[model samples]
Target: MNRNKKNISILGSTGSVGTQTLEVARSYPEAFNVVCLGANKNTQILEDQILEFQPQAISCDYHKELSTRGEIPEKLMSLSEIATYNGVDTVVVATSGNVALIPTFEAIKKGKNIAIANKETIIMAGEQLTSLAESNSVNLMPIDSEPSAIWQCLRGENNHISKLIITASGGPFRNTPVGYLPNVTPANALQHPTWKMGPKISVDSATMMNKAFEVIEARWLFDVPWENIEVIVHPESIIHSMVEFSDGSTKAQLSYPDMMVPIKHALFFPDRAPKSNTTPFDPNKTKSLTFESLDQDKYPCFEIALKIAKRGGTWPSALSGADEA
Candidate 1:
């Protein structure tokens, strides 16, 4: 390990966001040193990541045999253990759903910087978590593409924002008649047009639950009210998100719909390194960029999530848990 490299522990080292984060780490090896890795059940790739990164700690479901030949801790560490481990500079909380909440708060309480991708954590306890992070003086960087876009747009504005406009890809069934939604199979729903993601999030995108969660996340991350956050369906996905200033000025962040862009942004915040995984978005190829309001009837989850965001209790957690089950 280089003496000057920032040490980071990845909490969901096998998920979509986790793998993309590794790609960012791989591209900028001189800037980051991955010291710990955690996954749920994908031990095969977890072992591969352990070998490649040679992390001091590793973890997976309950317990499992690992095939790595390095000096990893004899006992597998839990996500929280890796999160709050001493000398860890940053904890990348990419674990899906509410699983990330406890470990994320642990890292925050321990004063470790957080780069988070899990929207469920915010939905479940955005108020509490943001307050905890602020009180600890820890940086709670957002890794979700939409929130990251808003973060970039809000830069230098210093709380001068009036509204947040979150963009949605509208999923595979955007054009499908509302009457046919009940018969859509899981396989059909998983086919996201612009982004490749896990099944749960993909399904959430289809139902607009993912956007709903993003609205909640944006509210917490930017300290905006739920009433000020709006969702629009941008089929092209070229524009990730936008922010409107109090004076009617609007700024937006645009990039190719690649998760690596946001992941890398979080990893080297306050600084930017050369990116290998994301290419500049081409407006010529984009042809027609369009936006439309979300059809409430088509995605009832959106309104429900907004209500849960305002309610701010265990309701959001319950909604996510029920979706998982």
Candidate 2:
């Protein structure tokens, strides 16, 4: 297959995932270009990135910019603008919270490839986003590890996926003795043993709300039935997710905990651009992998998300909006 040099933009360009994504692009400078960048409010990093990649556009919520007097990129502004940039062939939606909801639609309507790292957007507006994507024939690649695994399994196979099994690290409270949960501090919750992410996401991981949000996202993103999706507590973070077929066979995607794998998959699918660093999975480094059922008493957010997904209306909007507030 002939590979085209793709132009890329990243939403939440200052976040952990976004920085790593830029690292991936730098790894393969010949295959990809950073066409645009969006961030909450961090002009220093944004300026540094702009100096490095020289994206055609940039967007900061206007809050993170310490020095507003500097020369800003002419195309820098709102997400809708980044999504529709003429040079933006792929839009990496790495922004946190619900902001990804509308931009996902905007990028897809323009038929731009969307590397979706935001779960709230789908939890809040899955049906609307996917419908728009379908109408416009866009690729909504799941940058989240688990969903990416599912996408890989479904590629060019007779994949009648019977069940979607999501693996979890069980968060900071995995062994915190249930009694200590009520006393869990924000500091303690911020300490995720497996993944390095933003504070809001780390907090959500501690509560298992992140997994719940993924469940809702998978349902709408792939048009899978609710019951087909299942969650398991895998203390070892190696197995991102699994898929069980109608033939009683199961397939899973595993790697050392890193967001770059999925991000790269989204950016260059049907082909892989050479990476600057090679971090292959080593089972010898990891001991045993265990799976267990989630204790509902421990995570009510899971049930609440399930309810919202079933209701299938603007209720998700209320949930996402209320949580954002």
Candidate 3:
């Protein structure tokens, strides 16, 4: 209720990004206030968050079932309602897939700044959402590491960007032979070398499809042309991304593969905050940083995603839907 505190409503409070965002809030309690929390069906974790944060309102898909069992809170509200609530200054759209699209649109219309980690929503309706956010004077902040890194690299620059270089860890299968890729199991694909993420995203990372999605996301988030954006395999995952200016100089953002770093960056935009729970990058410990061209044959899914992105219609939405399925 402090006037100086940022009132936040996290839409996917139980997910990886959402929980990390809460960790940020916890670290800077005096700076942020949890106005609302929303999730899908993880009632147990949701209840734990509710007990800890004591938000003004909460939302979940199983609200009906909870109400029937007399376990629902009095402050229960729908995701859209939680998003546009009067007390919320920023809405963190961390839910996966298209679930956050309508709520995100509604929040933008209501003039709330959005700190979003959902790529599907952006890939599906980036044009519409960006235009709407611009008209409403709302900030559509990116919480994904790659786009957030690009954003950080462009913070103070005024020159035109020649290219935006996005880095990928190449996932667990970066060196897997093509002949043995079909034999790779789900457990093997989930073993990301640099970061710990959800199953779907980990699998996407292995297939390089996540990098492809990040490519499309960077295109919209930075308003850069498709041809101007590039991706490279950086197995070290130290440099999140880079931006090259028309003058031929490039700036890069480096960190030790942490999702919380980007989440904190997006939440505290236009200002830098002290590090919380994130490790400082140590250059001496890094042996070598290498880059390579992405092989289209090794990741046909990545190639197909780029094709769908270039099509630039409802095809991105279809791609997202198909991926979700």
What total of clashing residue pairs does each candidate reach?
0, 1, 0
Give candidate 3's total backbone clashes.
0
**How should the candidates be ordered by lDDT, best one leading?**
3, 1, 2
Q: List, residue by residue over 177-211, the lDDT tens digit for candidate 3.
A: 88988999999999999898999999999998899
lDDT of 2 at 179: 74
Q: For each candidate, give its TM-score against the true structure.
A: 0.95, 0.93, 0.96
TM-score of candidate 3 relative to the true fold: 0.96
Q: How high is the lDDT of residue 279 in model 2?
A: 86
Task: Quote the lDDT for 322 in model 2.
Answer: 61
Where does candidate 2 have its weakest 10-residue lDDT segment? 63-72
Worst 10 residues of 3 by lDDT: 64-73
Regions more than 4 Å wrong, model 3:
64-72
Candidate 1 backbone collisions, by pair: none
lDDT of 2 by residue, 217-301 (tens): 8888877899889999998888888888999999888888778788888888868656536487988877788898897878778
Cα-based lDDT for every prediction: 0.85, 0.81, 0.89
Per lDDT, the best of the predicted structures is: 3
> Would you give me the overall lDDT of model 3?
0.89
| Tens-digit lDDT track of model 1 for 57-143 | 776774456554544566577889999978898899988867878999999999999999988788788889999999999988999
